[model samples]
Target: MKTLTYVSTKSVNDLTWPTTYDNTNIYSSALSVLTDFQTAGPRVIESNTRADELVQLMKKEHVRMKIVVDTHNHFVGVISLEDLSEDVFIKQVAEGYKRSELMVADLMRPKETLLALSYTSLKNSDIESLLYSQRENTLQHLLVIDEGTKTIRGLISSNDIVRQLRLDVDVAFSSFEHTYHSAILGQKFQSRSLKVA
Candidate 1:
């Protein structure tokens, strides 16, 4: 194994807001999640990757979704927990074999919903607001990418953003906004119910 250390400068480009929607001001550089600890950075899949390969890898790692990168290293699409859940849904529909029997191609949904670009502020809400909104929504994950390359640079699920902000469930509950928190709120709501309620 090889380890490489490089110096990086912190900039606004590196900054990200938490799900709080409170605009509490979180510097993306403040905390480095596992996403930053990666050596090759993050696990990536080619467009041609088989559904079976992705399913096995995701299940093994307990991952709900992944970013799709092409041979040119260009961002193509996103895969979500809902997309992966297709395997289980499929099995339920067929009542035939286990979900493990399905492949990524057969199950993974095409990348559709998105949260591209880190610098782009979400809902123009504060940190707390963002969190509440994300939780109430139907999306399970949100991807942050480079606007120019459109390549995924980071992903922030309602869970990921919440954990980063260290917000409490009670606090989140007291501040849930019914409007202007669509994407964030919608996604979280989806995960908890596994349905876009």
Candidate 2:
């Protein structure tokens, strides 16, 4: 029999967490800000999940969006915190549907209405270029597609960009659309500063 040695925990005061790319500068690869499904699994929910349940889960996890899937786990659509806003629920209730009966699919952005960027293109781009290209759009989350594999690869969130770059703008009280616009504006100012230096 072999005996295993145990280390003392008394002196260990710090915990280690996983880290991604060390260089988070604007010129760094756009992938640095992406939540890659290949590396970290995508956040998903079943289409039939109750709206209230989805809201609770999102709030508890501090996630603003989730990919909607079917029983077979195929991506069908996406749902965001904005989609389940109190206003939307109130409107639905006014239309005669009970709150308890609402499902995620009822408010999700269908797959047909969504757009995705090619993984190949994202790999060749930098954060500055990516933000510049998407400056006019209000989409909170941009999905990445691996066209060659015919699969959903990952997503880039406006919040993630704001956090990763340590931007001065506060996103907590801002809507996703506002946050996206703010991030773009912040990036532009930063780019100009870099040029002036």
Candidate 3:
């Protein structure tokens, strides 16, 4: 009698990261893809937070954006790292405000100008339409408000959308893709002639 032994040709080291698209979710809804507030609430910093402290927090969190809040814990405005580093520092220095004296309230885009989309609108709309709207508005972030509660339900960002789609969706959104990256990651920071009040 003759016996044969089998040798395995594959090992764990031969494996590679998955490049396959998530074919199961070809059609997705806004609610399905959006970064819900419950999942990742906006990063918050006090209005009086020092510029240096803000930078340290951002580095620690690996985030480029934050929401400014007052001592009462009410939302006051929003600030991005680009605004802090590019616009604030230069403007403050030029105006003779010491760097150590700089605060987030001085650099934020105040809540009075907050722009948003209704939750109903987002629920009924598609990603392409949203991208076009964001591009037209030149916004990196758009709040979604629940009309019934009159409260912010979620936030959408170009970075989040791009990251979600990269997993599986293969449609060509050439112009939108460009707009998304540029709006979010691009350094187009500009200083206002006068400080925001």
Worst 10 residues of 1 by lDDT: 171-180
Task: Give the Cα error of residue 135 in candidate 2, in Å.
Answer: 0.9
After best superposition, candidate 1 residue 106: deviation in angstroms?
Answer: 5.9
Q: Model 3, range 1-197, lDDT digits (tens) per residue?
A: 99999878775467677443453131456565566676667678899999778888887887777878899988788887777775668788999998889889888889898877888988887665666566655445667888898767777765556566663222223233554444332423322323342
Error of 2 at 73 (Å): 0.3
**Candidate 3 error regions (>4 Å):** 1-27, 167-197
- Global local distance difference test of model 2: 0.85
Clashing pairs in 3: none
Report clashes for each candidate as comma-separated counts.
34, 0, 0
* Model 1 lDDT per residue over 1-197, tens place: 99999876764365676544344233333123224312336555666676556766877887666766678866567665566555566655587755545544445445564444352454243544444434445555555555555455555455545455554433222222322243354546768887545
Candidate 1: count of backbone clashes, pairs at least 3 residues apart or interchain = 34
Distance from true location, Cα of 163 in model 3, Å: 1.3
Q: lDDT tens digits, residues 131-154, model 2?
A: 877766666788999999999999
Clashes in predicted model 2: 0
Candidate ordering by TM-score (highest first): 2, 3, 1
Tell me, by lDDT, which candidate is best: 2
Better-scoring candidate (lDDT), 2 or 3 = 2
- The local lDDT score (0 to 100) that residue 170 gets in candidate 2 is 65
